[model samples]
Target: MCEEATRRQVGICLLCGLPGAGKSTLGRSFSATILRQRFAVITYDKIITAEAFHLALQDELDQSREIPPSSALLKTQETSQWKQHRQYLLEYLEHLIVALLNSSELRPPEGKCDGTWYRFVDCLEEQGLISSAGSSTEKGTHSVIIPENDEVCLVLDDNFYYQSMRYEVYQLARKYSLGFCQIYLHCPVESCVLRNKGRPVSIAEDTIRLMDKKIQKPNPEKNSWEQNSLVLDSSQLIKADDHRIVKLVNQAMANPLRPLQENLEIKEKDRAITAASILHQADQSIRRCISETMRRVKGTASAHEMKVAAQELQSAKSQFLEDLRERLCEKGIQPMTACNATTIVSLFKEQTDHIVQPFLATEQSCCLEPNLDCNDRASGIS
Candidate 1:
């Protein structure tokens, strides 16, 4: 293992926009002109090669025994395969970042990493970030080193049409306590389609139009996590000399995000309190219904008969509470507001009536029987 590398302030900058919105062009221009530090534009399109996507699609097809012969279904599968490639690219970037942070040799990813991983490593090597230096001491692995004192900002160039896609990058930044920022290239759908047409390998115009509808432009006011973001109109020429871009990068690097900390003790305590409140509500409702039933039958029945009925109701209440507790534990107790009193009272009344019905029937039978002694009837003898 290498000694700890210089703890420089590393940051991740995301270039997001629809295809042919000039994200890659802007990244190139920025990397060439940005001063005092190295910038590596990790383009997703290059990493997720055509061959890799074909294999992914093949795997998806192989997993399904029968795929319906529908263009829409095939398109959905293609999108899913593309997303898998995107995820793998993110993992590759994360692995690189981990190696840099730990000052360790760049080990190949374990378990099911395909050719794309090697291509990604080769891309970094080409940029002079990592190099081949395997020794006899280390067998069957690549030994690479990050250059000293190079505060590299990894500029991720991708068509992040969904906010969720960008959030995944932000989460990675937070996990490693790295500075993060987003740059969104805003271009009209028509202009993007026109620009895409000029390229040798063009994306479908319909796909770009679909992405335009789905794309979520970063709004700092709406999302606190996206405060370190900038939107540039790609219709106009964008240059690295732009002061706003410079300021945004500098500000993000200055302030790295802290990971969120969860307090399990507090959460458990809250759940316990909620469960207790629900149980208490249920108990009170059952007791109130039992008392009402006893009061309604008080004029016709003896004190001893009322005591018998009360015992039966109490037993049913205990069983109901036990079942309620078990339910809460299984499903997680809901909030206090969700525990409606009227609903609880109605349920308790229904169950309580069922429990007390037999006692009422016995009393009625005793009264209707001729030859039954008055003292025996008062005693509630059946």
Candidate 2:
């Protein structure tokens, strides 16, 4: 009848902010306070450093390799390579999740991973989340142990400055129907720079400042998927027993993300409704313009003249409506309200004047010369 006995709960917790924003500090607090669950904190900096070192060593061993001409160009290339390594880290985490879910051996897919994959595996082994499946003699045989208590949390500690980087993890959670949440460690740029100076492995102050400007903190109002997120000011010391942090994690684990599905039927139905609404509004606006135009010219023309002008205007309206509908719904050339009321009325009046101008002119000619027949004048022209 307990929570764990029912089903194992697994989730991803992202700790993201600027360097020295105390994300690692908060993650440790979370793991210590959150009871009756298995927790593993994956520190991205350590793995990234290992990968960078490997690349550096490779460059050193291969001295014949060509180097960039300028230091600026070299720095840019290094930044690009680091981005690739981050991508590989995400892929490695994805593979680990799959192995845990399937209760299978943790082996890299053929040609899908690089040196970063082994470092990731080593991190997991260090945390006791995975163990060697074969004897100690085997180098790469490993398997994930499904937690007995049915609750597991993987806290990813990194300076995920871009929304897209966090989105990748969200997608992974949705793919596996796992709970997902984020924690943003908010601190002044000055405070972060000061804190970075105190760490044994201090990052460059300029790099920390640059990341502070680039960091995109979680916004639930803007992004519905990031609803279960917590923001704590890392300038102040965070306690292990923070209520807000605890509540955020509990809510995420309670409601896991649903797997993605393409609902083509719903999408088609929505398109149909939108098309109908657009046409209906256009038809109503065009009809109102026609009625207003007729009212203005009512007393000026004879009844017969009015009747003839009305017929011509109705024909023009039909042609305009057909064109409008085709442009809006069929070809998707314009938005529903792209042509405002004033613009529509002005365009319709132009067509209306063209259609009814002859009638008004003919009527005026008949008034000036009573002896001449209006019918003869009209018939003789066409």
Candidate 3:
């Protein structure tokens, strides 16, 4: 069908990485390169920024009523409002993308205008974000129309890892029969932290630390999606004179379907690994907690407390065994002998030292700092 063929011609490329990982920069460069060959590019960041700007303006308008009239207050209010307005604009752009994905009939609003692009500016002006429709329409009138016969290459330079958005992107690509490729810009945590320090927009250190912790832990559910990924070490590129990012981009563009298929497989594996790791980690934590309780209860421990601790430990042991069995089954590892709870617990215990060592070290580190702080702070307070 003509409709199916049109959908097949649409291509989407996703650039994903931590903030300041060069996702936007690489996306822009790739867009420019592709544009030279006469391809259309649509960036998620540009759309989101426009929405953020509009939301900022609305926020300002809401605050203006509460503040007494003063030059400083007025200026501050105006700035806040402008920021809100920018957010709204970005949101509108997001909505536009969603609309386009949902219906083949949609086109960029600015592209639809037949008169001078100034007509598009007038439309935005009617929304009241801009003071006057500037005569020089060169700045704000850039728009692209999806042609009936032309192939479109869409470059998304935004955080596509968010569950809802990622799913939307995936579904859109499939629905449109678009070839999709995701380029993951992998950066070292230390390097990312250093880069964030110099940037105006930065994720907080604590947030980054939490992200690091999450990254280090494996989740079985995530294995299903990890198969479809290509990782590029941005940290290595940061030191190079001329990074071969373009080469990678070209390779991705050349074989989009292969990478997408591979990504799907990788995702499955990642999910299985992650699920196994979670079960293991949770069991270790539970055991450690029970051990500590046992120590505290040494001589005068209540019967109820001892019973609860034992129950907790038993629950963790049971769950860990269950998870391990599930993983073995998933991997097609048939048990020659039946795996009972006792056998499973004994098997896990044999591997406990290796699994629990890192956790023990982490626990020690956590306790060391807390003890030090308590002693010093308590002394000072007294």
Candidate 4:
């Protein structure tokens, strides 16, 4: 589905580079270089504060952990929360984009909308997105004013060092139905580390080295966003008028990208994921049972009474073991091997096996509760 837009110039510019690679500089200067592009800049550095980010991540994790058992439960929980978070963030970004598009049609009071353009910048500023440096004058007053252009753009600045980072921006654009492209600023690691040193709050040399290792250069062959992307050699000066950049910008203006989301497709995927999770949890549960049995066996310390009781408990659960295999096969899961299933079933029965041991030779009944106080009989304390 294509996002509805009234202006031709509306799109997203994602500026990605290492620390000290001039991302901020490019973001600040992007609009001025284009003749008719009205633009705003959103620096990721400001939007994601360390404390806020950590707290947010913790909340996502906590919420995810509440999900019921399934395959890769922890991993699935994390993935679900992240997708939800991205969708929410996309909604938030759409509000700003809508406000800007509305502002483009601004006129005098008689023809005016409910509020003025100030509300637009004010709302964004509160969200930690500042207007581009040159866009403002007289102490941040005129930052939101545009040059009466037919279209406007928003530029995102960040150390988009990973392909996943860029992918998020691409997904956002698709969701909003906007034209989107990335400008990959490539610089030598040595140059970036040296550049980082001059910053007010410098990054450690080691951190820069590690970040360099993690950086993923775009490949149009593997990523659709890269097809329209530009690679700027930030190791040297690149002009806005550079042929490659101009071509990309003009192409976007002429034909902005549309979104691709198939709800039906996703619904089917979710079902499969749910099934996998259920099966995975069931499998893990079996292993846990085996481990618990092993613990019980070791805890016995070779007590003769406990061993006899354990054997009795193991015998009592024979029917339960038979049913477990049938249940797993119904769900298309691999039926447990005879040896493996027996090993797992042995654990739960081990504690029960000793119920008769304490009574033996003392006229105690063999029929005792499976969950009776094991400590009174065979936890092997004696």
Best by TM-score: 1
Model 4 per-residue lDDT tens digits across residues 51-71: 333333333334434545553
Task: Tell me the lDDT of candidate 1.
Answer: 0.72
Ranking by lDDT: 1, 2, 4, 3
User: Under the 3 Å rule for N, CA and C atoms, how many clashes does model 3 have?
Assistant: 56
Model 3: residues >4 Å from true position, as ranges? 1-3, 6-8, 34-143, 146-150, 161-164, 215-228, 238-382
> Cα deviation in Å at residue 14, candidate 1?
0.7
Ranking 2 against 4 by lDDT, winner: 2
C-alpha lDDT of candidate 2 relative to the true structure: 0.70
After superposition of all CA atoms, the RMSD between model 3 and the true structure is 19.7
Worst 10 residues of 4 by lDDT: 105-114
In candidate 1, stretches whose alpha carbon ends up further than 4 angstroms from where it belongs are: 1-6, 51-69, 135-144, 263-265, 271-382
The TM-score obtained by model 3 is 0.39
TM-score of each: 0.64, 0.61, 0.39, 0.49
State the local distance difference test value for candidate 3.
0.46
- Over 129-193, each residue of candidate 1 has an lDDT whose tens digit, in order, gives 77666533233244545565666678998877668889999999999888899999999989999
Off by over 4 Å in 2: 1-7, 50-69, 133-139, 146-149, 267-382
Which has the greatest lDDT?
1
Q: State each candidate's clash count.
A: 0, 0, 56, 6
